[model samples]
Target: MITEVAQIEVLPGHEDQFEQAVSQAVPLFLGAEGCEEVDLQRSTEQPGRYRLLVRWETIEHHTDLFRQSQGYQRWRALAGPHFAAPPQVEHLYSVLAP
Candidate 1:
C-alpha cells in the first residue's frame, strides 16, 4: 500500500470551517476505489496547517483513479475555499513496519 500525504494551509480564521469540511468529505474518500483509509492531522504549532493522509492500494488509485473521479471534484468544491494556497502532496511506501 501507498500513503498520500497532502500538506494544506488554510486561510487565517478559517481553521474550524476547513476541519469541518474535511470531516464532511470523509465519505468521498471511503467510497473511492482502492482507498483503504483517510485521516487528517492538524499542526499544534500552526493551527491553520493540516496534513491529509490517505492510504491506497496503489499510487494509481489516487493519481489516476480518485483524482480523475467526480468525487475528487466534489472534494475540492467542499474544501477548496478554505485553502490559503494549493496543497503540497506526496506519495510514500513503507520500508519497514512493526
Candidate 2:
C-alpha cells in the first residue's frame, strides 16, 4: 500500500471554515477508486494546521488514476479556495527493518 500525506495550513481565522469544508470534502476521497482509507487530523498546538493521511493500493492510483479523474477536478474546484496555499504533499510507504 501507499500513503499520501499532506500538511495543510489554513489561513488565519479560517480554521473553522476550513474544517467545515473538509468535512464536506471527505466524501470525495472516500468515493475514489483504490482509496483504502482517509484520515484527517488537526494539530493541538498549531490550531490552523491539519494533517491528511490517505491510503491507496498504489501510488499510481492517486497520481494517475485519481488525479486524472473528473472527480479530482471537481474536488479541486470545491476545496482549492480554502487552502492558505498549495498543500505540502508527500508519498510514503511502510518500511519493515531488521
Candidate 3:
C-alpha cells in the first residue's frame, strides 16, 4: 500500500469549522476504490494546520481514479472553503517495515 500525506492549512479562525468539514468529508475519501484508510491530525503548535493521511492500494487509485471522481469534487466543495491555500501532498511507502 502507498500513503498520501496532505499538509492542510485552514484559514485563520476557521480551524474548528475545518475539522467539522473534514469529519463530513471523510466518507468521500473512503468511498473511492482502493482506499484503505484515512486519518486526520491537528498540529498543536499550529492551530490552523492539519495533516491528512490516506492509505491506498496503489498510487494510481488516488492520483487518477479518486481525483477524477465526483466524490472528489464533492469533497472539495465541502472543505475547499476552509482552506488557506492549496494543500501540499506527498506519497510515501514504508521503507523499513519489519
Candidate 4:
C-alpha cells in the first residue's frame, strides 16, 4: 500500500472552519475506488496546520484515479476555500528492512 501525506495549512483563525469542512469532506476519500483508509491530524503547536494521511492500494489510485475524478472536485469545493495555500503532498511506503 502507498500512503499519501498532505500538509495543509489553514488561513489564520480559520482552523475551526477548516476542520469542519474537512470532516464533512472525509467521505470523498472514504468512497474513492482505491482508498483503503483516511485520517486527518491537527498540529498542536500550529492550530492552522493539518496533516492528511490517506492509504491507497497504489500511488496511481491517488494521483491518476482520484485526482481525475469528480470526487476530487467535490473535495476541493468542500474545503479548498479555507486553505491558505495548496496542500503539499507526498507519497510513502513501509520499509521491509530497518
Give per-residue CA lDDT, model 3, range 1-98, as digits (tens).
Answer: 99999999999999888888889989999989999999999999997899999999999999999999998999899889999999999999999967
Name the lDDT of candidate 2.
Answer: 0.86
TM-score of each: 0.97, 0.89, 0.96, 0.94
Candidate 1 per-residue lDDT over residues 1-98, each given as its tens digit: 99999999999999999999999999999999999999999999988899999999999999999999999999999999999999999999999975
- How close to the true structure is residue 64 of candidate 4, measured as C-alpha lDDT? 97
lDDT accuracy of residue 46 in candidate 4: 85
Clash pairs, model 1 backbone: none
lDDT of each: 0.97, 0.86, 0.93, 0.93
Q: Find the 10 residues in a row with the least total lDDT in model 2.
A: 74-83
| Best-to-worst ranking by lDDT | 1, 3, 4, 2
lDDT of 2 at 43: 99
Instruction: Report the lDDT tens digits of candidate 4 across residue range 1-98.
Output: 99999999999988888888888878889899899998999999988899999999999999999999999999999889899999999999998875
Off by over 4 Å in 1: none
- Point to the candidate with the largest lDDT: 1
How far residue 4's Cα lies from its native spot in candidate 1, in Å, is 0.3
Q: Which residue pairs collide, candidate 3? A: none
Over 4 Å off, model 4: none
Candidate 1 TM-score, true structure as reference: 0.97
Clashing pairs in 4: none
Name the candidate that leads on TM-score: 1
Name model 3 segments beyond 4 Å from true: none
